[model samples]
Target: MSELERRYHRLLRAYPAEYRRARGAEIVGTYLDLAGPERRWPSPADAADLLRGGLRQRLRAAGAADLIPGVRLAAVLAFFTATALAAVWSVLELHPPRAEWGVPNAGPFVSLGIGVWAAWLLAAVAHAVAPGRWTRRAVALALLSTVAVVPVAALAGLPRPPLFVLLPQVGLGLVALGLPDRLPASVRAAPLIAIAATGLASVNVLPRNDLFLSYYSWTASQILPGAAVVLLLVVLLLGAGLALRADHRGGWALLVLLTPVGLLFLRPLGGAVDGNMRGAPNPGWPVLAATAVVVCLAGPALLPLTIALRKRRRGPGPVASGDRCPTCGRTAERAP
Candidate 1:
């Protein structure tokens, strides 16, 4: 199969397990059958058809609701678009001294703008393309990898590369290689560790003031602490989730408590350079305010990283129902 055709088939695994189980091989075979020869590349039309099929698989995996398959997707896309627009508008309009037209400081707005869009776009593509365990883990790695690259790029004045080009290539490669081991475990393992590494590395390399650059700007000291808090919260939450499934009320309750502190401390450092629009109306306020406003918004986004991690760790008891143990037709379970 051609590269596009191969990716198209991989995305099929993102649909619901039953759906994939029923149609996966058929989907792969269909691609192979249509391609004329396994070694031959797909025609442009064949490639387009498979691309649409891949998107359908991704959409199916996101949720089973039928109200409008595209609605949630539209909403998700609109959200990021609004985020990007708000950031850019704030910077350009409030370029400098207005400080009143909603621009606080172009710096915070800009950084937030970049962070929101980067997170949103990669996330959307991940959702669009991911059809199963391996792809998702690989996508999680890609995001962490992006976080890793940001600092390296910033500190080294590294060349900027197009993410659209990079994500699929890298994500596929990771899945092709490490995924054999990465998929069966939790989703967060790679991501949490990777984020932690990114955050930790920033301590020595990232500018202290950049922490204050308005994704809740903090000092470098605050960065590591905050990053640790994030790591802590994730572990607790995952452990709690598993614990809850195992009927460990105490563990769940304790884990719930960690959230406030983490929320109070955690920050999302996008590519912007300023803290807040202290002097301008940047998207800094909205993104940071949003992060602070709703505890749930980041839940799903973070969950991917969490699941990646959880997949690595032990699961909840038979109560962790979705993941049925193949051995006994029982769900993956953990000790309380």
Candidate 2:
């Protein structure tokens, strides 16, 4: 082989062995044809293209055969979200602005919380990078450990553990239980890095109270209505776009992302209504009403939009022919 051809073959190492075996020669031949005898090295563009294509193939292969795409997407998103939240919480617990909030000198409960987060983070990393039976086993063990420790800490008389403290851990455990034993490394890397970056940014930007306390509240006082409206609109638009693009799995993942936000409003709406009836100093009716409107509109609207888009994509009725329509199983003669 010429020097250029040799270098091209080395670059092909980016692709999986099976993919390379099937298409490597065809790709090499095309590159060689394009390069001609004069060229002695792979161009930067060629190297980049090969690398990108190889990474795409690797990710495509990472999907577990047993799980649907939606479930896999949800699992990855949940893991990343859980990891980020746990990291932030751990940081806050260790370094609270107030001495009362700081658990730096606490007993097993503090250790348990921090240790579980570390374990969960490691489990996610292992599942992403070394997906196998062993990885699944490790995840299962970590989840079990988390479950076991939480109640034990409570029984040991740690201050009434906050609802937020348990909720993320429990949610993550459930997601981990449902996830496939193996996942593609390529698919896992993006979410992992994104969560890490987000966690760091949030720790730096948000006040300790917002990170650790405000989320646990059931009132709208802590939430900004304008920001909430903007977020709701963004999520709705994103969901609509996903549906229109025929990305049902992605749409479902978006719903998973929105679930917590929806729940956040639910408690406050109820509290505000009850408080108003009793003449208490509640946040007021407008806050409750707006939350209700956003929650009601965002979820149900996506369904009809999705159905309409799908029907539109189906494109009128099946063509008239002697044979039956393969997809709808309706006879062609019966068509309008």
Candidate 3:
């Protein structure tokens, strides 16, 4: 190594000693390639900045970059903020969220805020406990869902969360259950399947005609639609919990797909009343309708965005390094 190379190696001492021991050559080699052969000695400040950037990148992967906590907090805030804001309208109008008006369901929306955040809480817990493919995907999905829910829910309210929430989870479950032996440690939560099953089973179990007639006014039962939504919420939590414990890949994936799909037919409007219907109860706000449209149409596309970001952060490893055999000591071992 020349004098410039020597100084660069010395500067690398600022990095973690063990990390330097393992990856020091590769990292320094990259910097050397960037700086080129005619390099001058790096100033103390330059050395410090390189070390800082490296450390920051590492921390972003391992530590504070866990966006779940922040997302959950935001969900919580959305819960209260939306509820409080809508409450003012309720007071002024002298009525709660009305199905006839086409507004979002206040109680369910607030309740769903809790449910959505709870699912995210489960995801964070899942990531903290396990860091495998399923757990990471679950965490990523929770974060993605959080980003999606904010504006969508702001418009849709709690009347019906989109069906996309837990639909993907069912696919995850099939995969998880298929390979019991190879299942990751985190996807072991036992209750997640039960929660999903309960959700799927309860879709139309609630006495629709009687209940719709009963609490259709004050309680807003008819507008609430199927129990699958609430069940999907539970599945989201339980699925995250399971993802943290056992392997249920296919099941979980399906569960994710189901969460949003369960609410497709559910419409808050009672009947037709567009521009000028004097008898029509102020046909709610279009936020609810617009939200439904967005969640249904936009949710699948949004999923890839989160997954892609994570993949970008975790770029492919060195060509040879990732191919090492776990069972054999031979670096050049053949695939099974």
The TM-score leader among the candidates is 2
Clashes of each: 40, 1, 65
Q: Judging by lDDT, tell me the better candidate of 1 and 2.
A: 2
> Which residue segments of model 2 deviate by more than 4 Å?
1-67, 96-112, 132-139, 180-184, 206-242, 251-274, 277-336
Q: Please give the lDDT score at residue 124 for candidate 2.
A: 61
* Model 3 whole-model lDDT (C-alpha atoms): 0.40
Between candidates 1 and 2, the TM-score winner: 2
Using lDDT, rank the candidates from best to worst.
2, 3, 1
Model 1, position 316: C-alpha lDDT score: 28
Q: Of the candidates numbered 2 and 3, which has the greater TM-score value? A: 2
Mark the regions of model 3 whose C-alpha exceeds 4 Å error after superposition: 1-229, 246-255, 258-288, 318-336
In terms of TM-score, which candidate is stronger, 1 or 3? 3
Overall local distance difference test of candidate 2: 0.55
lDDT per residue (tens digit) for residues 10-112 in model 2: 9999977877888899999998888856788899999998996775454334321111444455555556555655565455444322455663324433344
CA shift at 231, candidate 1, in angstroms?
A: 30
